[model samples]
Target: MYRRSFALVAALAAVLVLVPAALAARVHVRVEGKTQTIFGSTEPTLNVKANALDALDAASLAGEFYYHVAPTAFGPYVDQIGRYPALPGSPNGWVFKVNGIVPPVGADQVTVKDGDTVLWYWATFTGAAGPLTLEVETSIVRGKRCFFATGRNDAGRASRVRGVVFTLNSRRVGSRSGVLCTRLGRYAVRVAKAGAIRSRTYSGR
Candidate 1:
């Protein structure tokens, strides 16, 4: 009876250990460097432990890129991603935001929910607010995916951004809304402009 009880207790402990991992959040992660979209502009889906740092780690794994975290007085700070690190007294440092807003704390201290989008980018802060972020809105019409683009500043004000270039399967497509699944299936769509961070990679079925 004693042995059986010990085995049961061990099994319960095992189950408990696995629960948190199973409760891991499913998120979309995007990393943008100074010149181009570093990662997740092609594949953005990942399941990770709940935090912005975990989301970044998952992106590093999926994209096979590199990142570095440094300890700070507040908490662990991600000072580098890919080939870029935070420059001293320079605006070209790294910053992260969940769903278009930078949290009031460190990346390791922020909790990320399921379906959240985590963006890590090289920031070139010219003012209090950061750079312009881009996003795409898509709709289905007659089995075609119609894509519309927009840009928002750190102030949360958003507007339609025209002259958006659509890249379907890594090829520049002419029209935005005329692509259908018959032309491409189970693929990614990324839009870009001149001086804005690229939009999240929209996947089509």
Candidate 2:
């Protein structure tokens, strides 16, 4: 009886020691203000965190990305998946990849983590309802650092304006900075390391 009791205690101690270490190996991402774990045999995935409400309010903020309302060859860029209206109706909606390689809109539902990269862009609105705009900030899973871009109705609406910006610390790299700007409807930013980007964008007005 004594020998059997000792063996049971030893087995319980072994389990307690192993369980914590196993839990530490897992990782999670913050989406819509909720934390979720990533389960897979993969090392890297398109992992990013977003505060969807703030993203939609990016317009009307000055010095960011603003445009004028004018009906011409350029008004608003249409999305592929949702086909959401690109003007005053749903201005604070959708984030896309403008890196020329992959252009996807509406990243609110998409999940990304450390070592992941995202490119964001928007279009100008020109109609009887005036102009609309949008912005999106990207962050890594574990690091919690952030980088983002804002759109505006510049050029009075004949052209669509956009830009790309990012941070190095949030990317898990170091203190690094850069900026990618364009008025022709495209931009690019490089993901160098965990929290560093090829460029960054700052607004103070």
Candidate 3:
């Protein structure tokens, strides 16, 4: 009976060790529409076991990017991301969202779970016109995928754009034809159009 009890205890201990490893958070991190690092000459999707800041650190970009956090009554407030600083009197700065909804706390304080997605974007507000926006549309034409990217200035007017580019899975795809993704694997579409300073990534099904 004692041997059986010992065996059961060992089994329980094994489960206790395995459970947390199985439940460790797996998150996807993207910066400016590209994978964070190139591992062995191939861009691998970043999956972290901790929060967003931990994921950024795993990518070796924790100190490479510029940012500031202020000690606030609530918590640390992220003031800047990259070169975009939150203006003192403007509603422009770095805006971040997890799975499409803006969090009420800073990125460091937001705990992520498995299969979570973190997106960080820069919002530019200049001179009261409005914030510049870019939109990308994908379609299937002649059984081929195509992408149309448009950009609008602060005034909300479509302008003749340049530097509009597209990439799929971290590989640049031709502008005339959208990425011909023909597999069952995950794919990411990144678009940078007009004079926009940053690019955005759209996950594809």
- Deviation in angstroms for 182 in model 3? 15
Name the runs in model 2 displaced over 4 angstroms.
1-94, 98-105, 124-205
Candidate 1 displacement at residue 49 in angstroms: 2.3
Candidate 3 lDDT score relative to the true structure: 0.55
Would you list the rank order by lDDT, best first?
Answer: 1, 3, 2
lDDT of 1 by residue, 90-199 (tens): 77788888888877788888898888888888878778878778776677666765676777777557877777677767787554442323332465777777666777
The runs of at least 3 residues in candidate 1 whose Cα sits more than 4 Å from the true structure, single-residue gaps closed, are 1-13, 140-145, 173-188
What would the C-alpha RMSD of candidate 2 be, to one decimal place? 17.1
Q: What is the lDDT of residue 104 in candidate 2?
A: 32
Cα deviation of 137 in candidate 3 (Å)? 6.1
How far residue 49's Cα lies from its native spot in candidate 3, in Å, is: 4.5
Q: Least accurate stretch of 10 residues (summed lDDT) in model 1? A: 175-184
Candidate 3 residue pairs in backbone clash: none
Q: Which tens-of-lDDT digit does each residue in 73-174 have in candidate 2?
A: 433332321222345455442233321122232334343333343333332224433232223334443443344443323221222223322333233323
C-alpha local distance difference test of each model: 0.78, 0.30, 0.55
